[model samples]
Target: MEGDSKVVESKPHLGIPEAVFVEDVAKYLKEQGSCTCEEALKKLEENYQKYKLMEVNLLQKKQRLKQQIPDLKSSLDIVKHMKSIEGTDTTMTTNFFLSGALHAKAKIPPTKEVCLWLGANVMLSYSIEEALGVLNKNYTTAISHLDSVNKDLEYLRDQFTTTEVMLARLYNWNVKQRRAAKATTNGSD
Candidate 1:
């Protein structure tokens, strides 16, 4: 998606988000300098669609990231609970659900260290406190990433709205000029 749509920020327009520079807007405007009203309208519509596409993609990515946050935070909480039960024979049962249906429960190993699934089919042995630290760090990082994505999405929305407004203004201005010109020409005859 990133390769499919790119918004180059050479210079941002007024009232638009600083993070987004609709270079196409400037390019099209420059091209329309010598073109007719219809041509300028076409250019504005084309540029408007591009920004809209960007907004949609950003929204999708932000939603996916948001879904992951809850799961990651849940894991962090479990590890924190394990940290609380550190020494004593807390007798915790681990449950696994396959395909969101079948459930299997088993007793955790009777040892001070626990196995942590570190992704890519890899598992590592770590003490309860160590596991808590790792999960906490992961949750923190995920949260930070989510926040960044949210901020970007917001800025993208702002840019989209600003561009749309600018295009509408341009269209209205063109229509008014054409109307006034027609009126003056008709009166002269």
Candidate 2:
């Protein structure tokens, strides 16, 4: 099994770019010294909004992948079970759904071939060995993709926290700046 498994590289595009790292609030304000605190706050708010939107998208994708992984595993299991019984003389019979609320029974015959449904109303017949290979490849691919999605989600959550912190810090800095300006005016008068 170890020989069959290969390391799949996660796509780099799945995570946020390095350029978007959370900035230090004080450093950001210092760098933008010419701009007023309100402007810096507005920029920070925009960053927060962008992070929120990305989180929404990633959450949706994660939900879909979570649902799909189970289905892939189920299909793989069924195929493996079928392959296991191929050589045994034990006759297999089972009830199958014909349609909505309709059922029929069919006897299974030992054979080298199996049919696989490839979505979009397509089906293909292959030898048991070939079918197993296809199913295994698909299962591995789905598992790897799910792992990538999960990692991306974790990274995105960190980004959300960082952005929220920056927003709060920038807002507080803005308030302090306003208080200092008001004090100077009153004192000068």
TM-score of each model, paired residue for residue: 0.68, 0.78
The lowest-lDDT stretch of 10 consecutive residues in candidate 2 is: 4-13
Cα lDDT tens digits, model 1, 14-133, are: 223343233444455566577765676676677677667766776777687688778778777766666666676776687876666888997753456767777799999988778878
Cand. 2 Cα-lDDT:
0.74
lDDT of 2 by residue, 1-189 (tens): 554453223335464632234356567767777876678767767766776787788778878878877877876776677777888886567677789999999888777888888889999999988988998888888778778877877777776777677667778777887899999999999
Output the number of the lDDT-best candidate: 2
> How many clashes (backbone N, Cα, C below 3 Å) per candidate?
0, 0
Highest TM-score model number? 2
